[model samples]
Target: MATVLLLRHGRTTANADGTLAGRLPVPLDDVGHDQARAVGERLRRLPLAGVVSSPLRRCRQTLRRALPGAAVTVERRLTECGYGDWEGRSLSELATDPLWQDVQRRPSAVSFPAGEAMAAMAARAVAAIRDWDARITAQHGPGALWLACSHGDVIKAVLADALGLHLDGFQRIVVDPASVSAIRFTPQRPFLLALNDTGGDLRALAPPPGAADSADAPVGGGSGAR
Candidate 1:
């Protein structure tokens, strides 16, 4: 089996301020850098095959600090959901909107006013995860350790797919900022090993000692309005 770790980028200025960053290029704040280092230091012990990240500045920043020495790539498919008119807006400002209510409870039925469809977002996110999982396993072996750092909604969509849940239920899957969720992919089904794990004890993912794998030893915040 091949494993993939889905990580939400660290807190950005928008996140810290409760703004919907959407697909904007918001940079991580000071606390975000600290959060990135905490997760990075923990995962550094693993034999990470590589790192894939959203092209957004915040995610790129998080990936750089979290896996300083790993091979990295910018995957547009892993970018955050397009929040359209809601971009850069505060949650309190949109709390009473009918679309917000629909999105929170019945996402599959609603599409952002001038942005992406939730169904399409979930489809592409799942596709990207599958593509990366296969590529990492083929390049580094089945017990490969790799990461995809993305946003709250994107990560939740992937997790919902892994659990065979419909897109409408995706909101139920919480992905805090800088959190990690583990998934093991097989021909049969994708198995979820962890969800929203902010703690740093992921050493079990590394291959056993001297197991022919190049390796070493072992190792949130709120879900933004992504």
Candidate 2:
């Protein structure tokens, strides 16, 4: 197993406009670039085994600034959930729709008209992350760390899965633009190391010597990350 950093793409033009960008090719706004660079500064302290990204433009732009010269694997499964008829619509306006209630309270059952289902989005995202985690561990050893830049809802779904929460409760998890959530996968289960972290020291995420292969939790929360 390996550690995976889940990064939501920086804010975009649609975000500032309160619109749902969905799978549209929206690029990051000016503030987003600054956020990306700041996260990059923090991430530079760790040695990332690999970097993967959603195929969407905003995600790609975020990674381009965050990792600079790092090679990025474009994963379609990490792309934004298709909002279908809701695409490019203002969130304030969508809130008035009858379907919006379902989206807010029971996302597991939400299937955007002419778009992808919420359950389906969660399935693919968790699968992609688990698969990539396995690959990174195998290629670079259990201590390896990697990153995946994706959309907000998609990342929230993945985090919900990691937290062992039902999709209906996903809205409770807020994934702000450019924030980072971390998870470490093990044979027994996945451990959520961080959630919706906007600004925090990430160096502690690197495994300590001789500890990478252990999946057991520290007894009594033995010595916090060094």
Candidate 3:
């Protein structure tokens, strides 16, 4: 299996304004562009086999600044969770709704009014990532690395799945804008290599030569980072 880097799109006007821009075509703010550029610099340290993005404007803009002319595949399944009636509403306002508590505490059981269910979002996202990882491994080899730029909630759900946590506990995972998390899939299970990493050396993520693709975890975490 290949390593996949999950990148949350940069901050947007809705983000700064405390609005839920769910499924809306919101653009990134000025700060978002700077953040994207910075992350792009860090990403240049590793050789990414490919980049996939949500079919949203903010994500596309972020990638434009992050990877420049890099070809990006737009995946509809990676799009922001459908907020339905809650789209473009302020978060503070939504907090007063009865469903808000469930969203924070028991997301697995809560579905947005006229929108998609949280569990459904998690299912589609995990499936998309797994499929992409398999495809990348087949085309680029097991040691290959790739990236997916998506929304905050979608990334959180994916991370929760990778960490073997129930969807209800996903609220505990915080995916800030422009942050990057990493996961490596093997025959046995997925390993979370990084989480909500805003700044760190990413070159260590590259597998060393002759490394086995489906190597199992060492009893004591093996040698740290080769």
Model 1 Cα lDDT, one tens digit per residue, 1-226 = 4688889999999988988999888999998999999999888877778788889999989988887767789899988888888898999998878898999889998788898888888888899999988898898887777889998999999999989998889888888889999887777677677899898588865544333232221225323212
- Prediction RMSDs, each to the true structure: 7.1, 1.0, 1.0
Q: Cα miss at 164, model 3 (Å)?
A: 0.9
The regions of model 2 sitting more than 4 angstroms off are none
lDDT of 3 at 214: 53
- The CA lDDT of each predicted structure is 0.83, 0.91, 0.92
lDDT pick, better of 1 and 2: 2
lDDT of 2: 0.91
TM-score of each: 0.89, 0.97, 0.97
Backbone clash count for every predicted candidate, in the order shown:
1, 0, 0
